[model samples]
Target: MDAPALDLPFDAEAMLPGLRRWVECESPTFDAVAVGRMMEVAARDLALMGARIETVPGRMGYGPCVRASFPHPRAGAEPGVLVMGHLDTVHPTGTLPALPWRREGDRLYGPGVYDMKGGNWIAVEAIRQLQRAGVATKRPVTVLLTSDEEVGSPSTRDLIEAEAARHAVVLVPEPARPDGGVVTGRYAIARFNLRATGRPSHAGARLADGRSAIREMCRQVVAIEAMTTDAATYSVGVIRGGQWVNCVATHCDAESLSMAKRQADLDEAVERMLALRSATDGVSLEVQRGVTRPVWEPDGKVMALYETARGIARSIGFDITSQSSGGGSDGNFTGAMGIPTLDGLGVQGAGGHTLEEHLLVSSLVPRAKLMAGLLQVA
Candidate 1:
């Protein structure tokens, strides 16, 4: 069945109001109540453009995943392109004052504006444009928005992979680089927690009898830090233990960050971590977590998708460039599934996860137009 052609006018500026509203609403990870409100707004906006919206349940106290779709014009065509983004931000309920839309010349300041509430709006506007122009795409279209991305997408990773496998290509609307280049490759992230145990004793009286868990932890930390090489990086981020100044610490826990360029590096790191035994005979060790996201290498299929995206950008008078990043995203999950994924298709800005996070207002319209054009061509 041919879907009805849409002729709705899509103004990039027209999306700013809604985008700012979304940014102002604090939808932090696992805040199911707040996230539900945000999803309601998105579903309303998408419905106006003739989209069917459904919420995919999530586990582990994560926000819901939304799937909005517009059927293809012709029956028995190829599957659709999936325009993906997330609704969650790193900010809690009120980490900083929720900055509304502020235009200082050509920049818009707000939380998750560029890092990616703005990107979601861009995708919606693009689809609206294609429908309004009466363009009959050869495939169906789906936009999957998750609410757990800022927190590593613990719950929606499976849903994302499934959607990506069903699509022709996955376009991630993460914020572009400050230089306006798209991202073609992203690193995998593996976050782990390490714990050590020791007997407690009075520091002044029985210091010799008590084994220091902190000391054992320090040895393991030094060993892990030493494993960092050019291809991979590791950091002992947090350490917490000890009861009193005059007492030998009975327990110590530490968290580490591990990055790898390839899967083998991750496996080696995990093996090393699991092999960690207490340096002191009296102490014990535990490895709590392991690899979270796999590395995303851009193979030939991914490169071809990027080439097509670059052509779409060129048609809209935007010269797009690609680069590799050590940071991970949902794109990493999709790319690891052997699906062609391209990221950084949103506004270009910097200061992510900080107070200064802002988006270039000038880039918003052009990028939106480019994305809209890509949907038309795809």
Candidate 2:
């Protein structure tokens, strides 16, 4: 027998107003008050969708998180679908006023529009459409909107993991790839503070007595850059050194990141960074580990989930493909726990975390329909 029909009634065009509002809010990750305000806006909307909204207190000096559960007619929260996203953005609070929201052709440009305020609205629109059709989802659906994802999701990681443990699959709408693909796996990332300490002396009068920390740091930077290969990377992003050119640098500090395609590769990269020795005779090198995100490799279960989602997408006039992303998301955390996850299921767009960020307006409805179909099916 043929499968029953599915009618996804979300008007993609009508989503502009709400999305525009979210973009205008400017909920930057670093601004506590602004991020909290944005969460309130989302909480009100989620409550209107018959969801039970919970305010999870923010940790480590960040804004609060919103947990909205839209229960199934029967199952409630018993092993359902988990939707993950963030209200926090990389742009500051004043970015919206200067950048503003505008559309050129099919691209909608604004702060946080593509990096994922648009994707977040896709979830809301999906729920609204289901309610309008009087369609009950197959299982409970939980939406997690955190306030600190752009700066590494430090506050929301534990909460996200705890919630994901109660669900079977995690759907991360982290803005679909501009090339029309979803994220199946992501690279692991490790950050570090590389500090070099050395004796300071006058550069001109006692050059031989001076042990330059900046020179040692430059040598370490060269070594780290040499370690960058196809499968792994080590790049120094920021550096600081002596105050004056006439004095030997007493201390030097640098921030670097290591990215790897696999756990073993990441481990190797970290080992290399930690083992780095000072080049100057009197300089000492120290590395302090900062934020680390595990690689989300495509395991059996995650790939299986993608297969089901691909079939649904094909039925809706779009043949979806799954690909690996170099950037990590919250999916990396859950995937580390061996939970099935599919990231980048959001609207298609380009230039995330940049001024040119935009969403392909044409993708709104079809992608929303695909998401609704996934939720309705399971």
Error of 1 at 135 (Å): 3.0
Which one wins on lDDT? 2
Candidate 2 lands at a TM-score of 0.91
Q: What are the per-residue Cα lDDT tens digits for candidate 2 across 1-378? A: 012224666687799999988889889988888999999999998998888999998878899999998867655526988899998998987787666799999988999998889988997898888888777777788999999887678788899899999998889888887677899899999988999999999999999899999999999989889989987998998899999899999999999989998889999988888888887788999998878898888899989889988888888888888888887788889888898998998989888888888899999988888788877775
lDDT of each: 0.80, 0.86
For model 2, give the RMSD to the true fold.
Answer: 2.5
The parts of candidate 2 lying over 4 Å away from their true place are: 1-6, 75-77, 200-212, 241-249
Model 1 off-target regions past 4 Å? 1-12, 75-77, 98-101, 201-223, 238-249
The candidate 1 region of ten consecutive residues with least summed lDDT is 1-10
TM-score of each: 0.87, 0.91
